[model samples]
Target: MTELVPTPNNCVLPRIRADFATFNDAIDYAAKSEKGMNFHDMRGTLTRVYPYSEMRADAVQMAYRLVDAGIGKADRVALIAETGPDFAALFCACTLAGAWPVPLPLPTTFGGKDSYIDQLSVQLQSADPKVLIYPPEIAEMAAAAAERQGCEGVDWDTFAQRPAPEVELPKADPEDICYLQYSSGSTRFPQGVAVTHAALLHNLYGHAASMDIGNNDRVVSWLPWYHDMGLVGCFLSLIANQVSADYLKTEHFARRPLAWLDLISRNEGTTLSYSPTFGYDICARRISSQSNVEERFDLSRWRTAGNGADMIRPDVMQNFVNAFSAAGFKASAFTPSYGLAEATLAVTVMPPGEGISVELVEEERLSGTRRDLSRPARYRAIVNCGKPLPDMDVEIRGENGEVKSHHQIGKVWCRGPSVMHSYFRNQEATDECLVPSEDGKGAWLDTGDMGYVDAKGYLFIVGRAKDMIIINGKNHWPQDIEWAVEQLPGFNHGDIAAFAVETENGEEAPAVLVHCRVSDPDERVKLRDEIRDKVRAITGMNCVVELVPPRTLPRTSSGKLSRAKAKKLYLSGEIEPFRLAA
Candidate 1:
C-alpha cells in the first residue's frame, strides 16, 4: 500500500496578485500555485488531494461544455452544494462560463425526503435555473424536484463525462452576478441573494484582512457549502487569496463531531476553522467526562477558532475551553463574528487574540422594555462581535429610521460593496430591506438582526428582531426561555424551541416545544411540569410547553434551530405533542 500525503500548507509562489478583479480571475491565478484542497473521510483519514492546477483544467473543460449546451452569460445553473471535487470544479466552471451558479442545500437530517424535495422545488422555482446538477447519490430526489420545476437535472459525475467540443466561454465582468445564495431560514418563498463578482471579491478581501490571514495559515472546515460562511469565507476566499485548505464533509462531522478536532490535530501548521456555537457545544459534550483530550489531540497550533452563524454563547464557549484546555486550546483563539447572507458573508470579525468579550446587559434593555421594579434585574450576556470590516459601514437604526446612540440596540444596518445587489426577481422584498441612506451615498441593508455597537466600535448581537415573542406589550426573547429550560437535567442546545402563539382566548403567550427523552408516562408528565415551571420563572407567566420526541424539532440547512418552522409545524398539526396523563 502507498503512503498518504496531504497537500502542502504553503507554496513558493509569490502569494496573491494585487487583487482579483473577478472570481474567475482568482481561479485562474490560484491554479498556478502548488497549494490545493485536501479532502478527509469520516474517521479523519486523508482521502483525496485536489490540486488547484488540475481543478482549473477540469473547470475549463466543463466551462466549454456549458457553452456548447447553450448555457450562456447570466443564465442561472443550480447546483447542490456538496463538499467534493465535482461540485468545486463545477462551481468554478459556472463562473468561467459567465453563469450565476445557485448553491442549494443538501437534504439535512431534520427534513425527510419529501420535505427535501419540496424545499428544492421552491428554490428552483425562485432561481429559475436552466439546469439542476447534483451528485448521483441523491439523483432520485434531485431529478424529482427538477422535474417538478420543469427543468433538466443531471448528476455531476455523468455531466463531467459529456462531450466538450472547444467553444469560447463568455467573459465574466467584475459587476456580473457571481452566484445566487439563499438564506438558511428558507422553508417557504425564500428570496435568493444575488451576489456579483465585485461584491464577492470585496467581501473576501474584508474577511481575509480582518482575520489577518498569515503566511502559515491553513483552514480546516466542516461547514456546509450552502451557507454563506462556508461558500464564501472558507471556499472562495481561500482560492482568491491563494491559500491551502482541508475539508470534512458536514454529514461526517455530524456523526463524529470530534473528528473535526482529530483532523485539526493531524495538521501541525497554524490553522483557521469556523462553526456555529453548536459545533463547539457538541464536541465539548462528546469529550466532557473523558480525560484524554490532551492525549489524543494537539491543538497547540490551532490559531483561530471562529464562531458565527448564530448568537455566540459564552457559557458554551467557556465549556469548550474547559474541555480542551488540556489539549492546548487557547481561549484567546475564539474569534466570534457577525454577518448575514445579505452581506455576502462577513460584516464584522473579532481580531485575532481578542477572544470572547461579553457584556452583561439587562434583559429588558435587550428587549427594549421598561424595568420591572417587582423583580430583580435579569442580565443577559452579549458577546462582542468585533469591529466592522474595511469599507463596511455599520449602523443601528431605530423604528423611525434614525441612527441610535451607543449601547442602543436596534436593527443592524450595513452598506458596502459586499452587500448583495438584490434578491433575485423580488423587487418588493428588495425595496423592503435595502433602503437608501440619508447621506445619499449608497443603499443600506436592514439586516433584520437586533444589535448595537459599543464606544470602541465593537458590535454586540442581541437577537433576531423577528424571533421576539411579545405578550401584553412586553417583549421576551425566545432564547431566554430556551436557555432556562436547557438548565434542566437532560436538555441540550437545540433541544428546546420557544416562540409566541395565540391562546384559545386570542391572547398572545410564549410557547415552547422541548425535545423530551423520558419514556415513563409519569416521568414525562413530571418533566413537562418542570420545564413549564422553569419557563414560567423566566417569563413571569405560564407558557405553553409541549414535550415532543427527541429530534422532532426542525433545524435549518446550516443546523441552526428553526423556531419559525417549528411553530409552523406545531400549529399545522404535523408535530403532535405527547398527551399528558390527566
Candidate 2:
C-alpha cells in the first residue's frame, strides 16, 4: 500500500503508508484506494438523476477554465450565484487555482433588492475582487455591482466558455490564503476573515476525525453556500474526504421544509448536515401541519445533525427531535456545535455517538455569581458544545488576561492551525480579535464570547461577553430573555432586540424593545404583557417590554439583529418609546 500525495489542484485523499520506491506506486495506490462520490447541483428535480462522477469532472474542468481566464494564485474571485453546481464548481475552481473566493449571499435573504445591492457594494469595495461571476438571471445585477465598484462582471456562461488549460499546478503552502469569509457584522461593519489552505485542511481533517467520516458516507445538506458552515462543513469536507453528498437550495428548503428531510431519507445520507434556529422552526411547523409526518421519512441513517450559526436552544432541539422521533430519528443525532467564520467552520463539535448532553444550573447562581458547572441545580439548562477539535486548544480568560479555572465564566481564546491568518488588510480590527498571549509570547484568537470549560473538558457557551446585560448586580444573556419574549404571539420572527439600558441615575435594567408587525393597538399591548410575563416566569427578572412598528429593529448588512445600534437609537430618542398600561 502507498499513500496518495495531494497536488495543489486536488485534495489529497487520506492514505496509508508502505515501502514504495517510485511515484507510480503512490499513484496506483491512490487510484485503487476508492475515491468518494461527489455531486453538484443536487437540487430541484435534478438530484435524483445527476451522476456523481460527472459533477467532479465538471468541477475540475471549471477549475482549469478559471485558471485560463487569468484567475491564478492569490487572485480574488467574487461569487454571486445561487447554491448549485455553478457555485460549487466556482468554489472548487478557486481552490484549485489557489485563488481566494469571496461568496456573497443572494438578495432573497434580505428584505429587498436594494438592501442586497447595498451590502454587496460594501463587500465588493472591501474585497476589491478582480472578477464577479454570477448566474445568467442575476448577470445584470452583478454587472451593476461590478460597475459601481469599478470591477468587471463575467456571466457564468462566458466564464465557463474559457478552455481548460494544461499548465502544471503549483504546490500550495499550508499558510497561503484560501478564501475570504465575510462576517455577519451584527454589531459593526462586515469584515473579511482570510482563511488559509492549511487552516481549511486542518479543519476538514479535524472534522473527519471527530465524526468518523469515511468514503462510504453520504451527506445531504441545504445550508447556503455563502455561509461558512455550508461551504466548509458540507461542501469542502465532502470533497476533501471524497464522500458522496447532495445539496438542496437554501430558499427551496425554506419554502418547503419537507424537502430537506426528504433528501436525507431518499439518499440515505449517512453523515454531515447542518442548520440554524429558523430551520428547526420551519421543520417543526411543517411536521405539525401534516398527519403521519414521522412515517414519511426514515432518518435513522443520520449520524450528525449539527446545530449552529445561531444561538442553540435546548427547547428547539428537543421540539425538533420530538417531532421526528416517530420516524426513527435519534435524539443523539442532534450535535450542538460552536464555530464562526474566523475559525474556518468548527472549533468544537459535540462528541458523536453520545446523545444530547446538557447541564442544568440555578438561574440565580448563573446571574449573580460566577459560572459553576458543579452547581447543577442552581442554574438552568446549558447545552455542552463538546470538547475542542484534536488540533486545537481552548482557554477561558478574564478581562485581565489571566486564565480562569474550570467552571469559571470568561472570554474564550483559541489557538490552532484552523484559526484564520487575519482579517484581510485590517490590522486594527485584526489586532482587536487576535490577542497576544498573556506572557507576550504567542498569539490567540479571542472568540468575543463568554463561556467556561467543565471539569470533563466540555465547553459551555454562556453568551457574548459584550451582549451580557447587567441589571441590579445580576447578569443575563440577552438571547435567553429575547427568546422568551419572542415566543409570545404577534412578535415578528426577526423584529426583536433586547439589551440593558442605563437610567439617568446610572442604574442598569433589562430593556426589551420588540417590533410588532401587527396593526391592532389593543393586540400589540396584550402581546407586550404576554412577553413580559413569560420573561419573568422563566428568569424571575422584570423587564421593560416596548412594542414598536415592524422593521423598526436595526439589523446588520447580513440581516442579523444589531442590539448595540438598537440601544443607541433608544438612548438618542430616535426610536419611539412605548409606555406600559397605567
Candidate 3:
C-alpha cells in the first residue's frame, strides 16, 4: 500500500546547452539534475519515479556487466524496446560502454507470433548484434529470433542479475557511432541508420530549440521507442536537454488510448506530446461523442501536440480540435513536423503555436498527370510540415540533380550536421541516398519523399515517389485512391491499402485492398464493387478491389499501413481476400 508520486514537471537544474562532446557527456550532465523520467500504468496512475542520478548509477552497473560479458566498444547490442526503466538504463549503458544500442520494436498485435519472429530474425541478421536483450514476457520468441540469427539472446532480468567486476569503459569521441536506428518499414531489407554522437546531439539541440523548450516544459509520450520520433525526439532528447518527461507504455496506450490524455490531465504544466495522425484520430473518435470531454480532461496547458511519423491529415486535426475544444484544448497547439531516422530525428519542426496549415492542390498536379476536361477537377490537401532546423538546408531537386523553384514539386533533399553517418555496412545503399557535395560541406540526403517549399519557406509534402502507381504513362498516388475509397460509407483510416498490381492482360492497374466489416457474402461483393467503382471514378480507369477482414493488412512497426508489404502478402496468397461471386 505505497503511494507513487510522479517526477516534478520543473526541476532545479540549470538549463544546459546541448553542445555536448558526445551522448555520454550529455547523460553525465543530466545526471546532476534532479529531473528524471516518470512511468505510468494503464490507468494513467504513477508507477515509478526514476531519478537521473539513480539512472546513471544503474547504467554504470549495466555497462560493467556488458563489458564483463566481452561486449565492448563498437559491439552491437540489440534491445527490444519496451517502455520502462530497464530499457532506458540499458540504452544509456550501451553508449557508456562504447557499444551501439539498436532499439527494435516489440511484438505488435497486428502481426502474430511467426510474423514478429521473422521480422526480428531479418533485422538481427542485418545488424549481427553481439547480444539481443528483451523482456521476459517475449523471451520465447526473442530466443527463437536470436537462434535463427545465431546470436546470444537473454531476458533483461537475467542479464542484469549477472555479476559485474570493475572494468575500464571505452570513451567515445564526437565522431563515434552511438547507435543504429532501423526505419519503421525496413523489415525484409533492414538497413540500420548509423548515427554519430555529434549528429545525435546536434539533432537534439535543433529539436529542443525548435520547440523553444523552457525549464518548465515537460513531455508526456506514448509513442513506441523503436521509432525515430519516439527514441530521439522524446527519450534521448530529454536526457540531452535536461527535461523531465513522463511515459505510458505504447501497448497499454493501444489498449486504453484515453489513458494518454488522462496522464496529460493529471500532470500539471505538461506542455509537449507527439504522435502520428492516427493517435489524434483515435482519441478524437474515442471521446468526440461523449458530453464529458471537460469532465474527463483538462488540456488547457497542453501547449505542443506534435504530429509526424506519417502524412499529416488536416481533417483529423480539425476533428481532434472539435472533439477536445470543450476541455480547454487550443487549436493552435498542433505542431506538425517532417523527419526520418536517416536524419536522426527533427529535420524540420513547425514553429510552435502554428496549427495545421494545408494547401489545396489539383489532384492531377499531385499525380504528375495532365488534367482531362471530361473529368471534374479534384483537389488534395497537402499539409505544411514547416521549415528546416537552424543547421539544416532543404531543397526540392529534380531527377537531374537541379534544385527546383519554390512551389514546384520534386524530391525532398536535406543536408545538415544531424544527417546520419551512413547505412551500417551498406555502402551501396548509403551512396544511393547520401549524395556527397562537390563543395565537401556534407552529403545531401535524398529523402525519397516528394514535396515542395512555399515562397515563405514552409515545406508542403506531396507523397512518396516509390508509392506512386504508374499506369499508361500517367502517375497515380495511392493515397488519392485510398482516400477516394475512404469517402464511402462504413470505412475508416488504415482500412484500405492501394498499390499497383499486374492485370491479366499484362497491364498494370491500381488494386485496392479494403477491410470489409460486413460478414454477409452478398454484402461483401457489393462493398467490393462500390470500392472498385469509387477508385475508377477517381483514377479514370478500372481497378481491382478486394475485400479483406479487419486487421488483415500489414502495418509497419510504428503503426502506419505498409502498402509494399500488403502487396507482397496479397500476391503471395498469404492474405486471401473475400471471394466475390463469379
Candidate 4:
C-alpha cells in the first residue's frame, strides 16, 4: 500500500464563483472538489486530510443533530475553537442550521484553570450560547464555565453521537447573520463583532481580488481559529476560493514555531500564510543558532508572507527574510496588512510582490506633537500597510471628528459593505464607534486605531488611540517607549507593557511595566532606572517604571499584550512588582 500525495501544487481545481450569498453556498460549491484541508503536526507530517465532501456530510448530520437538540435558526452556538475537524464541522453545521456560531478561544495559554474559566464565563455570558461544545480533554473547565453561564456544555464526542432527527434545515438568506467574531482585545476588552452573510461574502470577494488568490495558492496557518485572521482569512477564504489549506494547532506552533515554515516548505505550492509580528520574531530567534536552514527548509514557494494582528515590526520581518533568503525566500513576499474583527478580517492588503514600504515620520509628528521648526527630527519607521481592499474606504479622522489630511495621524475609520452590522448585544460600544459616513450612504466604523495614510494611499498604523500617553500637552505613543526598551540586549520582544497612570493629584503620568528576568536586586534596580531614563529621554517627562516577573503581563486571547488589562491589574495591585530603588 502506498500513501497518497496530498493535493499537488499544479493540480488546480475548478474555481468556484465567489459571489455566493452565504458561507453555506460557498461550502456547497466546494464540496464538489477533492481539494480540502490537511492538518499537519510539528514534524510536518500529515495528521488528517478532510475533504469538503465529507465535511459537508458530517456538518449536515451535525446540523440535524443540533436541530434535534432544540437549536434553531439565529440561535447562538458556542464552540471552543480548537484547530481540528470536529470544530470545523460544527462551525459549518451552524451555518446549515441557520444558527450563529461563536468561536471561543481554547484554554491552553491562560496559565491556570480558574483564569480560563473566568474568561470563558465572560464570553459565554456575552454570547448567551445555547450550547457550548468543547473537546473532552477540557471538560472540567468547560463544564464549570458552561454551568456558570447556565448553558449546557457538550463534549464533541457526545454531540456527534446525538440523534439526527428528520427535520427541515433552515434556509439561509443573504442578510442573515453569518457568525460572531470576537475582537482580539489587543488594546481594549474583546467585543463580539456581528458579521452578516452579505458583509462576509463581500469581504471575502474583496480579499480574494486584492490578493489575486487563485488555484495555485495554498494556505498554511498556525494562527488560532478564534482570531479573525485564522477564522475568516485562512478558513473561510479557502472554502470560498476552493483552495487547499494546511493547519497546525496554535499551541503546537508555540512549542515548535519552525513547524509552520516547515509545512510551507514541504508543500510545493505557492503558500499563503499570515502571522503577527511575534510569530516571525519567535521563528527567527528559535532557528538563529541552527545551521543548514537552506537545506532543511524550502521557502522559495512561499509567495505571500502576511504580517498583521498587531503592530508590524520591520526589524522582525527583516530578520525572517534574511534568515530564510538563503532558502530562496524573497523580501518582496512580505505583505503587511491592516484589519480588525469589526471589518471581518481584511481591510487593506499589500499587493503581492510590493513587500513592505515604510515612512520615516518625525517622532514628534508620530506622537501628534506640534512640530518645532528648529528641533532636529528624530524619525520612526512606520510600516506601510498597503491600500484598502475594493469597496472598502479608509479615512483618518481628527480628534474633532473631522477627516484629516494625508500623513496627518488620527483615528482610523473604515466603511464598506463588509463592515460588521454591530457589536453583538453591546449597543453602547456600537454607538460609540459606528457612525454615519459623510455622504450618509453607509455607516463608518471608528477602528479605534491611530494611523495615517501616505499620498500613495498606503496606510501606516501608529498605535492604539486609547493607549496614547499625553504629557504636558504633548502626545506620546506607548509603543515608541516599549520599542526603545526592546532594543536593549537583555530584553526580548513582548517583555514590556507601556501605558498611562493617574497620580494622586489626578495628573496623568506615563507608566512602564517591564518583565525582568534578572533575579539580582541591584541589577533589577539598574534595569528599572535605565528603562525610566530611556522613556524620559523620548517623552521628556518623568515615567514610573516597575519591574515584574517574566510572563507576568496579561495577554489577550489573540496573544497580543493587553495593555489595558495590564494597567487595570497594576492599578489594582494584582500584578506584584519587584522592589527597585528609584
Candidate 5:
C-alpha cells in the first residue's frame, strides 16, 4: 500500500493561511471562473440563474444596500425569504459586509391567521435581527413583528433598489464569527452555533476535496438553507469552489419528490445530494409509485449521492439501489457521511470513489459489554460515516477520558481547524462543549454523539450519548426502540417519541409514546397493539405504548419531534392519553 500524502497547498488553503488577503484572492479566482457559470434558478422556476458577472454585481449591490440599511459589521440580519436568487444574493452581501445572516424557516401553521402570526412573532423576537428582509406576501407579517420589536422591515423590492455601496471590505481575522446557525431545537432551547469565516472556509475545502467537487461539477440540491448541510454543503461550497449549481425550493421538492431526481437527470448533475434518510425514502416512495422511473432518465452522470444529517439506514440504501439499478444508477454513488453544525459542516466524509459499508452488530452485545462487534442473528446495521477530513483527528473516549479501543462505544470527540470558534454569546455552554481532556494537551469539541471505530479505521455512529437511557443497569437508545415501533403500520409515518421515564424508586424503563392522526378509538387500540408487538419482537424489552391525538407530539421550530419535551409532558401528565393497545 502507498503512503498517504499531504494535500497540495494550491488545491486548498488551511484556515490559518486563509486570511482576508487569501480570501480575496480566492474570490478573484472564483469570479474569473464564473464567466459561463449560472448562479440562479432557471426560467419559470423560483431560482435565479445569473452568470458570474451578474452574481458578483448583484451581491456587491446588495452589500451596499445592506450597509445603507444599517446592517454593517457584526450586525445580525434575519432573512425570512424562501430559497431563491435573492436569498443567495443577500447572504453573499452579508458575508461581504461582515454581517451575520440568520436564516429562519417559513412559518407553518395550519390552524389559522392568529396561529401563523404567533409563530412568526416568536421567531422574530428570538432572532432580534437589525433588519428583516422578506417576500411580499410575508412583508406585512415581518413588518408587524419588526414593529413590535422596534426593528426595521424591508421588502425585497425596496431593498433591491439601493445602489451598490463602495465600502472597503474589512480584513477578516481567523477567529471572526461568520454566521449563527440554530439547532433544530428538538431537545431544548435553540442555541446558535457561531461559525467563523476561517472554519467555514476550511470545512468547505475539505467537503470539496472529499466529494471531488470542481468548477465543472453542477450541483442541484433542495435541502433547506437554514440547515448547515444545505447552507455550507451546497451553497457556500459552490460559491467558494466557483462551481455552478441549481437549487430547488424545499417545499417544491417535498411536494414533488421526482422533481429532485428530474432536476439532476435534466441537468446531468454530477453531485446528487440530500440527507441520508430523505434520499433513501424519497427514492423508495418514488419507485413504489412509478415502475418506469428507471427507464425515464439517465442517472449515470450522478457521481456523488451524499447521505448525512440523520441516521443512515442500510435497508433503505439497499432498497433504493435495487429499485433503481435498471435506471443506470450505480450503487457506488451512494456516499454516507458524518457532520454537525458545530463542526461548521463536515468533519468526516467517506473516502472518494468508495460507496457505503455497513457492519452488522448484535444489539444485545452493544448494550451489555460494548465489546466485540459480533454479527447477530438479528443484526443492527451500522454504516461507515467515513474518515476524518484532512488536518482533522477523531477519537472515541470513554467516561474516564482514555481513548477506547476499536469497537468500544464512547463519546465522539473531534479536533480540527474546521471546529467553530465558540457558541454565540454563551461562554459557559462553550466551555462545557469545548473542553480539554484530563491530560490537557489540546482541546476537542465534544460531539455528544456515541460511536466507535472499526479495525479498518471507519467511524460507525450508533447513537447520541446524551440521548441514551440507563434503565436497570442497561443502556438503551431511544432510536433503537423508536425504530422498532416506527416499523408498525400506523406509527410508521407520523410524529413519534420514545423516551425513558423513572418510577417512584427512581429506576427508569423504556416508555414509548406515539402521537398519531387516527381518530377512531378501535383503530387507535389496534395501532398501539401493533407498535407494542413489533417493538417487543425486535427488542426483548417490553415497552408501554401510549396513543395521543394528532399534533399532540411536541415539535421543534424546525419540525423535529422533541423527545425531551415529550418526556416532560408524559411525566407531568399534561398530555391527554387517548387509548392504548390491549
Candidate 6:
C-alpha cells in the first residue's frame, strides 16, 4: 500500500460559486472540474479514487435505472449509509431521479444482529422506502429488515446490473426534499429530519462562507455518512465547493485511528477535519504505545481541526495537541463548533485559525443553584462554539419560554433557513419542538439542548435539557458528573451513565451506572464507594452508584452512550447489577 495517493492534476481548485439552487446543480458544475473524493482503508491504502466526472456519469446511469425499476419522483429510497463509492453514487442518483434518499444507520458495534434488525425495521417502516439497498457484506441482515418492511432488497452488485430507462431523466427542484437524516437518537427514538434542497443548500453556503473556504481547502474525515455532519459537511460540502476529500471508514478509525492522521500527513494540500472529543482522546492514547511520532505524520497543513457531534473537552484537545505537536500539529488549529441534524449540519463555526477558546463560569451560575457568597468560588470551563453562521439566530430560552441573557444557561433555540422542514410523518414530535418566531419569517427549532452564548456571541453547551439532573430545585448536568468519574484510573468515556431517579419519598435523587471491570469483591465495592464520593463532592448530593459489566451500557448508532436507554433498561431490570457471591 502506498503511503500517499497523489491528487489528480485536474483536481486543482476551481472558483467557488456564491451559492447553488440545489445540490444537483452544485454537483453539475463540480463535475466540470476533476476534483472528487478518495476512500482509504485502515492501512492508509487508497481503495478508490472517484473523480466528479465519473461519479456524475455513474449517478446518471443509476438514476435512470431506478426510474426503470418503477421509482418515481418524491419516492423514498432507503440506503444503508456506508463510507464507499456505491453509497455516494446511489445518493446522487436519488437526487437526480427526484426521489427522496433516506440515509439509514449501519449496524453499530454495540448492537447484535437482532438489535440491528429491530433498528432497521423501525427506520424502514418510517421511511416507507420503495426499495432498500445495502452493501453485500450485510446482505442477510438487510434482506431480513426489508422482509419485515415488505420492501424489495437489492445489493449494490445487483442494483448496478439493472438497465437504465430509455427516457429523459427527471430533475430535482430546490423546494423538493433532498433526503431524510435520522437523528443520532441518543435520548429517544430516531426521527427522520426532512431536509429540503433549499435548506440544505443554504446551510452549505453558510458553512463555506463562514469558514472563508477557498480553493486550497481539502477535507479528511472518518465521520459516518448516516450522520448530518459527515454527509453534508464532508461529502456534499466538498462537491458543492469543488474540493477534494479523503475518507476512512468509521470502523477503520476505531481500530487504527493513526491511519487518519497518516493520510493527512501525506497530503500536502491545506486540510480540514472534524471529530468529537473522544476521537482526539483515543488517538492521543494510541500514540503513547507507538514510537517515532514526529517522523510518522505531518499535520502542520491541517488548518481546521473541527470538534463537534459531542461536547468539546479542553483537556482532551490539549493532550492531542501536546502529543502531536512534535509532528508539527498546532494547538491553534482546533475549531470547536455546535449544530444538530435539524439545522442541516452547522449552526456555528469558529472562524478559521482562531483555535479553541473557552470561558470560565462559576459553578453555581452554570448549575442554576444559589451561590453562597461566603464560600470560595469554583469555575467550570465551557468551550466556546463560535458564532452562528450569517443570517442565523440563536437564543437561550428560560423555562417560561422567555429568552435568557448572556451567562444564563437555558434551552438553546435557533432560527435559520438551514433548519429542517419538519420531522417526517411525526407531526406531534414536530409541533412539540418547532414554534413560530416573533417576526413570523421562520420558525425556531427547540434544540432540546441547554446552553448559553457569551457577550462575544460564541455558544457554550452545558448538557441535554432532558438529561439535566434536578434534585430539590438545583440543576446538575450529567456530563459534568460523568466526566468527574471518568478522571479516575481504569475508566474511560462512555463507561458511566448518570440520571435522576425518584426515591421512596418521591424526591428526585441522582443515580449512577458505572461499567465495572474489577472482579474482586473488595475492589469492586471500593470503586463503587469512590464513584459515590466523587459525585457527592461535585454536586453535594448522595448518588446511588451501581456497577455493571463492561460493554453493557446502551449506545446510539454513532457510538454515543445512550443515557435514556440505560435508564429504561435499569428501571425494567434488564440491565442486571454486578454482584459478588458471598
lDDT of 1 by residue, 364-476 (tens): 78655588799999998899999999999999999889899999988899999899999999999899999987778789999888899999899998875467664532335
- Superior by lDDT: candidate 3 or candidate 6: 3
Q: What TM value does model 5 have?
A: 0.75
lDDT values, one for every candidate: 0.86, 0.70, 0.88, 0.83, 0.68, 0.84
Clashes of each: 0, 6, 0, 0, 5, 0
- The digit string of per-residue lDDT tens for model 5 on 138-176 reads 776677777776788887778897676577765556567
**Candidate 4 structure, TM-score to reference:** 0.82
Whole-model alpha-carbon lDDT for candidate 3 = 0.88
Q: Kindly list the per-residue Cα lDDT of model 3 for residues 205-243, writing each as its tens digit.
A: 998889899889989999888888889988999999988
TM-score list, all predictions: 0.83, 0.74, 0.83, 0.82, 0.75, 0.81
What would the per-residue lDDT of candidate 6 be over residues 1-582, giving only the tens digit for each residue?
A: 555443553444455643888989987988888788888888878878898878899899999999999998889999999998899999999999898998887876653676578768878888889999999999999999999999999998899998886678777788889999875332124578999999998998898887777777788899888877788888888888788888899989988988889988987784788887778888898997777888898998888898887667788899898899999999989988888878998999898889888788887786666889899998878888899998899999997899999878999999999899999999998998899888898999998888998888888887755676645323456776788799899999999999987678544578999999988999988888888887776566688888999999999999999998898789869999887442
lDDT of 4 by residue, 1-582 (tens): 567557543343578537898889998988887778888877778878898878899999999999999899889999999998999999999999999999988865523676568668878888889999999999999999999999999999989988998788988999899999764332124478899998999998988888888767888998888888889988888888888888999889888989988888888885788888778888888889988899999998788898887777687788898788898889999998988778988899999899988878787776555767897778878999999999999999997899989888899999999999999898998999899776887999898889998888888898755675644323355776788688777998789998887688644578999988899889888888888777665555678899898999999999999987898789769999997665
Better of 2 and 4 by TM-score: 4
Residue 177 local lDDT, model 3: 98
By lDDT, the best candidate is 3
